[model samples]
Target chain A: MKILGAIIIIAASTWAGFEWAKKLSERPKQLRQLKVALQSLEAEIVYGLTPLGQACIHLAEQLPKPLAWFFETVNKKLEEGSSSAQEAWDSSLNEIWKFTAFRQGEMEVMRQLGATIGKHDRDHQQKQLRLALIHLEREEGEAKEEQVKYEKMIKSLGFLAGILLVILLI
Target chain B: MKEILDVLPDTIRRVIEQMDTDIKKGIEEIRIRILRPLEIIVDGKSIIPDSDGGKHVITPQESGQLLNKLSQYSLYALEEELKRGYITIQGGHRVGLAGKVITEKGQVKAIKHIASFNIRVAKQKVGIADRFVPYLYDGKWLNTILIGPPQTGKTTLLRDLARIISTGDIARKLPSFKVGIVDERSEIAGCVNGVPQHHLGDRIDVLDACPKAEGMMMMIRSMSPDVLVVDEIGRKEDSEAILEAVNAGIQIIMTMHGNTMEDLFRRPSIRPLLDMGVFDRMIELTRANGPGTINRIRNQHGKEVYCKKVI
Candidate 1:
C-alpha cells in the first residue's frame, strides 16, 4: 500500500511538471502565431486597403483560437462604431490576457501598433506594423531560448523533489 | 433629411430635432464647425440653434465624436474620399469637409483636423425634366448641354432627364432609351452598395464614383448606351471623351457650370466643343423661381427658342 501511495505521488508530481513545461514552451508558439497574424495584417492593409473591421474579421478566420478571438472582439467593437480602433484593441488585449500569455512589453508593442493601424496612409501603416513585428520577433527569440533551456529542468526537478520527500518520510 | 440627422452626434442631433416643424422640413444644409454654433440653412436663411436667440456652440470633443461616427472609426478606409474633400453617406447626402491640407509635391495627400462639415441634402424631383425632353429631341436624340450656376438644380434636372430617357415618359409618349451615366461624384444616382437608391429607370446603368473621362469611354465600350449622360464636365480630358463618345454615334446629354452662352465661349475647355457644334440644343437654368427655372433655350446657332418662364 505504501508503494502504491509513492507511485501515485510520483506520477502526480511528474504529470504536474510536464504540464508546467508545456506552459513554459507555449509562449514562444503563441508569439510565433502572432507574428504570422501581423504579417497577414500588413498585407491586408497594404494590398487590399480593406476597412479595419473587415480586415480584422478576415485575419481572425485565418489565425488560431484564442488569438483569433482577440481580433474578432476588436472587429465586433469596430462594427458597432462606438469605439475607435485603438480603444477596441486595448480592450480586446485585456480580455485575452487570461487566455494567452503575452508579456507586459509585448502587450505594450501591440498597443502601440493599435494607435496607427486605422489612422494613417498605406505606407505609414505598413511601417507601423513592421515595427510591431520586429518587437514581437525579438521577444519570440528570447522566449524560445527560455523554453528550450528550462523546460527539461522543471520536469526533472519535480520528480526528483518528490522522490527526496518520499525517502525522508520513509 | 432625417437620415442625415441620424449620423450626427447626439448633441447636435438634439438641437436639430428641437427645431420648428416648418423650418425642419425646409432645412437645406447643416453646417458644423468645432467650437462654433451649429447652423442650419432653411430656404437660403441660416438658423442657429438657440432657445432665446443665443447660439448653442459645439465643443471640439463633440466634433471629434461626429468625425469618428462619419468615418465609422476607420479614417484610413476613407482616405480617398477625404482627399476629395467630401464623404457621401447613406441616403445620398454629401458631407463637405474642410480642414488643414496635407499636400505631397503640390498634390493634396490628405485632410487633417477636419474642422467644418457642410451636409447637403439630396432632393429628388421626379418629372421635372418632362418639359425639357420634347425640346431635347425631334426625331432622334439631340446632343444637348445644360448651363446653370451652382444651387440652380441642374443636377436634379439632369437626374430626372436620365430617368425619363431610360424609363420613357408615358405622358409625353417617349420610349425608353438605354442611358449610361458616369456618376463621378455619386450625386446623380446616389448608389449605395453598387445599387442606385433613386429611381433612374429600367435601361440605365451607372458607373458610381468613376472619373468622368475614363468612365465615359468605359460606358461607351462596355454598356453601349443609346444616350450617355455626365454631370459637370469642365476638364479638358472630359471634353475629349465627350467628343469621342459623340463620334461613336452616342447622343450626349451633359451639364456644365455656366449661366449663359458667353460663359461657354469664355471657358477654353468647352470653346472647342461649341465650335464643333457638338451640342444641338443648349438649355440655361436659373434660381429666379426657386430653382429648376428655365431661363432660356437656344439652338446650335445661338437663336433663342423658348420665351415664356417655365419652372
Candidate 2:
C-alpha cells in the first residue's frame, strides 16, 4: 500500500511538472500566433475575391515556376557534387529572387532577409518566412488589382447600356 | 558448283562464318573462279589470311570449316550479297542462289541454295533468248511454264525471259509489256534489297525474299501490270494464288522443278492446281529424254512445239 501511494505521488508530480513547463513554453505560442495571422490574411483575400480577383489571387498564391525550378536545380547540383548544398541554394535563390521587387512594409521583410541571409543556417529559415509573407502580400495585391479591373468592366457595361437606351428612344 | 563459288569475294567466306548447317554445307562445295589468291578481307580492308604459313591451296572442306566461324549476321549479309546475283569469291568464284522456286507449299519462294549453280564465266550473249522470245507471246501472252531438272539453265532462261519481256530485243521486236516479277528467290531480278543486281530490265518491279504467292498478290496490288513473272510454283498457296491472279486478269509466266507434266499431277497438294490449269503452257526440258535442248513446249489444249534437239 505504501509502494502504491509512492507510485501515485510520482505520477502526480510528473504531471504537475509537465503542466508547469508547458505554461513556460513560448515557442508554441509564437508559432501558433504567426500561423493564425498568416492564415487569416489568406482567408480574408479568398472571401473578398471577385472572379477575376480569385484568378489573380490563385496565380499569386502559386510558388513561382522559376523559383521551384531553381530549388530543384540546386538539389540536383548537390547530388552531382558540383558545389556545396548551401552555395548552390544561395546562388539559385539569388537568380530566382531577381524578379521579386523588394517592397517595404509587407515586402520589406523579404528584401531585408534576402540582403542579410546570403548563405547561413538561419538564412534559409529567414528567407522561407519572408517568402511566405511576401507571397501572401502578392496575392492580396493581385486580388486588389483584379477588383479594379472588374470595376472598369462594369463601368463600361453600364456606359454601353446607357448608349443603347438613348438609341432605342431615338 | 566449284565454278559458282569462284565468283564470290574472299571476304564473303568470313561473312558467312555463322551460317546455318545447310548453308555451311553448301559453302563447303563452292569454289572460287574469279579473284586471285592471298586475299583476306576484314571489314572491307583486304588483309592476307595467315593460311598456316603461306599455303594458298584452301580446299572447299577447309573453306567450309573456316565459314563455320562466321557470325549469323554475316550469313544474312552474305545472302543479301547472293541476292545481288553474282560476285567473285576468294579465288574468282561465281555463285547464283536467288531463283523462282517450287517451295514445299507449291508457292513461289526465293531459292537460296547455290544448287545448280553454273560458272560459265558470264559470257554476255546479248541475244541469247532472242529466237525463243517471239514464241512466248501468242497475240497477248501465252502463260508459259519452264520445266527442268536442277542446273539445266532454267533460271538463266527465266532471267532472260524477264529481260526480253521488259525490253524487247531488236529481232523478235516485242512491245516491252509491263512485267511484274515476284523475285522472291531473286532469280529474275537478282535484287539486293529491292534493287536489281542483275539485268532483269527497267520494266520489272521485283519483290525480293518474299513467298511467291504473297509476292504475286503484292505485285498485282502495287504494279497492276498486264503480266507477272515468277519462278518455281509448287506451293498449294502459290498454286491457288496464281489461279487467283489469273482470275484477276493477270497473265503468269512461271516455272516449276519437274521433268514431266505428270510431276505436277503427282503432288497431292499441287494436284488440285493442275486440274484447275492456272498454267496454260508446259515446257519440258531434257538433256537425256529427247534429242535434247529445250525438248518441247506444249499448249494446255494439247499441242506441242519442238525446239532444237540437243545432240
Candidate 3:
C-alpha cells in the first residue's frame, strides 16, 4: 500500500508537470491561431465591410475554443444593445484573459485594439488592425522563445522534485 | 418606422413609443440635434413631442449612440454614407447626418463629429400612382419626368410608379414590364445592400447608390430594361444619359427638383433635354393639397393634360 501511494504521488506530479508543459507549448500555438483569427477579422472589416458584431460572430464560428468563446461573448454583449463596441470588446477580453496563455503585453495589445475596432473609418480601422497584428506577432515570438527554453526543463523538474520527495520519505 | 426607432437612443425612443398612435402614424421626419428639443415633422410642420414634464433636449451622447446604432456599431462600413452625409437604413428610412465636414484636396471626404440627424420616414404609398397610370401609359409607358421641390413626394410617387410598371395593373390591363431603377441616393428603391427594402415587384432590378448618369447607361446596356426609373436628375451627364436611354428604345421615368416648366428651362444642364423633347410627359408636384398632390401634367408639346381644380 505504501509503494502504491509513492507511485501515485509520482504519477500525480508528473501529470501536473505535463499539463504545465502543454500550456507552455499551447501559448505560441494559440498566439499563432490568434494571429490567423485577427487576419480573418481584418478581411471581414476591410473587404467584407461587415459590422463589428457580425465580424465577431463570424470569428466565433470559424475559430477554435477559448478564442471562439471570447468572440461569442463579445457578440452576445453587442446583441444586447446596451454596451458599446469598445465596452463589449474590453469585457470579453477580461473574461477570456484568464483562460488564455497570453501575457500582459498581449492583453494590452488587445485592449488597445478594442478602443478603435468599430469607431474609425475603413482605412483607420485597417491601420489599427495591422498595428494589433504587429504587436501580437511580437508577443507570439516571445511566447515561442519562452516555450522552447523552459518547456522540457519544467516537465523534468516536476518528476525530479517528486522523486526527491519519495527519497526523503523513504 | 420600427427600424428608425431602433437607431434612436433609449430616452427618445421611449418618448416616441409613448406617443399616440395617430401622431405616430403621421410622423414624417424625426429631427434630433444636440442641445435642442427633439422635434418631429407631421404634414410638413415640426412639433416637439411633449415629454412627461420637461422638453426632451438631445444630448451629445444620445446623438453618438444614434449614429452608432445606425451604423450597426461599425463606422468603418459607412465611409461612403458619411461622405454622402446620409445613411439609408433598413425599411428604406433615410437618416441625414450633419456634422463637421472633412475635406481632402478641396473635396468633401466625410462628415465627422455628427451633431444632427434627420430621420426621414419612407412610407410606401402603394398604388398612389393608380390615377396617373392612364396618363403615363399610352399603349406604351411614356418617357416621363416628375418635377417637384424637396418634401413634395416626387420620390414617393416615382417609387409607386415603378411598382405599378413592374407589377402590371391587372384591372388596368397593363402588362408587366422589365423595370430597372438607378437609385442614386438609394431613395427611390430604398435598397439595403443592393436588395430593395420596398415591395417593388419580382421583375424589378435596382442599382443602389450608383450615380444617376452612369447607372442609367449601365442599366440600359446590361439589364435592357423596358422601363428605366431614375431619381433627382439635374446634371448635364444625366440629360445625356437620358437621351442615350431614349435612343436605345427604353422607357425612362425620372424625377427632377423643380416647381414649374420654367424651372426646367432656367437650368442650363436640363435645357438640352427639353430642346430635344426627350421627356414625353412632365408631371408637377406641389404641397398645395398636401404632398403627392398632382399640380399639373403637361404633354410633350407643353399642353396641360390635367390640372388640379382650385377648390
Tell me, by lDDT, which candidate is best: 3
Q: Give i-RMS (Å) per prediction.
A: 1.9, 31.2, 1.0
Evaluate model 1: give its lDDT: 0.87
lDDT of model 3 at position B307: 88
* lDDT (C-alpha) at residue A61 in model 2: 46
TM-scores, all models, native as reference: 0.92, 0.45, 0.96
Across residues B1-311, which tens digit of lDDT does each residue of candidate 3 receive? 88887778889999899889988999989999999999999877878987888889999889878877888889999999999999999999999989899999999999999988999998999988999988889999999999999978999999999999999978878999999999989998898888999999999999989998999999999998999999999889998999999999999998999898879999999998888888889999998878899999998889999888889
Positional deviation of residue B305's Cα in model 3 after best superposition, in angstroms: 2.2
The parts of candidate 3 lying over 4 Å away from their true place are A1-3
User: Candidate 2 chain B — worst ten consecutive residues by lDDT sum?
Assistant: B65-74
- Report per-candidate TM-score of chain A alone: 0.96, 0.28, 0.95
Off by over 4 Å in 1: B51-54, B138-140, B170-173, B192-197, B303-305
lDDT of 1 by residue, A59-142 (tens): 899999989999999988876665467888888888987899778878889989987767777888889999999999999999
**Pairs of residues clashing in candidate 3:** none
Error of 2 at B96 (Å): 8.4
The order of the candidates by lDDT, greatest first, is: 3, 1, 2
Best by TM-score: 3
- Candidate 2 stretches with Cα past 4 Å from truth are A1-170, B1-55, B59-126, B169-173, B288-292, B307-311
